[model samples]
Target chain A: MVNTILIMAGVLMALGILLALFRFILGPDVTDRAIAFDVMTVSSISVIALIAYFAGRVIYLDVALVYGLLSFLSVVVIGRYIERGL
Target chain B: MEIRETVGAAVTLLGSVFIFLGGLGIVRMPDLFNRIQAGTKASTLGTILSLLGLAIMNEAWIWKLLVIIFFVLITNPISSNVISRAAHFRGTRMTNKTVADLLSDKNKKISEE
Candidate 1:
């Protein structure tokens, strides 16, 4: 039952990632793309968490933590560049 | 134990659905700020719920999941705010239905000073 649910969650998240990717590629403006990228990162974090649960690895939580931080930093940097002349 | 696993999995599945809706919002929203708002709000909740579900499934990692949840909640909105502000400053065109220009006056004041 647990495996079945995890597989279902994985499929749903994969579909979400595909939508995010579509936005990222077809976005008219850089900010639109950035927004899509942000969504993608968050979804990926959830995916990582689900994967960890499936694998029964506590260590993967640490990976999720780092990835979340990196995603935040990347978004901030992108925002700064877009706001200014960078 | 079986009941706990089933409940956790159900919660996780719901969270994933929210995340999918957020992604859909990003693709369908009319403007940059709208997309940012949709993506940030929905995904934050989605991620938190999924993490909480995972914590429930694995009792030992509850503390670590709590920490991750804290980081996600803190950073998600801040990044979204930064992005929206950037888009505003960069003069990304707004949709026709936009109702307010609260930031325009502030931007003028800043430029004047």
Candidate 2:
């Protein structure tokens, strides 16, 4: 049962990544791409969490946490740069 | 034990579904702000749910999962708000159906004063 769930979640994450990639590539505006990138990061965090569960490793959770922080910082910096000539 | 594992798996699966929907919304939304709103809310909740599910599966890592959830909750909205504000300031065009823009009105008042 656990294996089945892991497989299903992996498939869904793959689909989500594909959709996010489409938006990131096709988005007309910079902000649109920024939003798409944000979505991708969030999905990646979930994927990492799933991997941690599947592998029974706790270290990946720390990686997810760090990745979340980095994503937030990147989005904020990009937003600021877009708003002003920074 | 079997029941607990099943429940956790189900929750994680549901979270994945929401994440997928968030990506779909980002692709399909007509405007930038709409996409940000959709992506932010859905992804935030999906992430938290997935983390919670993982915690359920691994009881020893519950504290770490909770920390990640809290971090996500705080950061997601802040990043979305910053992006939307920046986009608005940069004159990203809104859809024609947008009835009112309070930020623009406020800016006008400031300029007039």
Candidate 3:
């Protein structure tokens, strides 16, 4: 049962990533792309956590933590650049 | 097979669905700010839900999971707020259906003075 649920989750998350990528590719402005990137990274964090549960590894949680931190920083930097050409 | 695993799987599944909806909103929203609102709100909840589910499944790792949740709860809103403010200040146009824009109006008034 757990395996089946995990498979379903993987499929859903993949579809989510695909949709976010579509937005990223077709986004008219840089801000649009930045938000798209933000959505994608957040979803990926969930996917990674699910994968860690599936594989029975504790280390991957740490990876997810670092990924969240960097993604947040990237979004902030992009916002600053958009605001004032930084 | 245990009760905990079943509950955890259910929660994770719910979270993934939310994540999918966030992506859909990003694609379908009319403008940048709308997209940002949708994407940020939904994905933040989704991430929290999934992480909570994972923590439940592995009781020993609850502390680390809570830390991740705390970081997400703090950073997601701050980053989105920053981006939206930047977008507004940079003069990103709103949709036609937008009812009011006090900030832009105030900016215009100040410039007029």
Pick the TM-score winner.
3
Tens-place lDDT per residue, model 1, A1-86, is 88898789888888888998999999998888888888899889989888787788889989989998998999999999988857
Q: Distance (Å) between predicted and true CA of A73, model 3? A: 0.6
The residue-by-residue lDDT of candidate 1 on B9-103, one tens digit each, is 88888888888888888888888888887777888888898888888888999999999999988998899999988888888899999998888
TM-score per prediction, in order, is 0.94, 0.96, 0.97
Clashes within 3 Å, all models in order: 0, 0, 0
- When 1 and 3 are scored with DockQ, the better candidate is 1
Model 1 chain A weakest 10-residue run by lDDT = A49-58
CAPRI quality band, candidate 3: high
Evaluated at residue A58, the lDDT of candidate 3 is 87
Please identify model 3 stretches exceeding 4 Å from their true place.
none
For candidate 2, give the lDDT of residue B38: 78
> lDDT value for candidate 3?
0.88
Which pairs of residues have clashing backbones in candidate 2? none
| lDDT by residue (tens digit), candidate 2, B1-113 | 98888888888888888888888888888999888877778878888887788778778999999999999999999999999999999889998888899989999999999
Q: What digit string (tens of lDDT, one per residue) describes model 3 on residues A10-50?
A: 78878888999999999988888988999999899888888
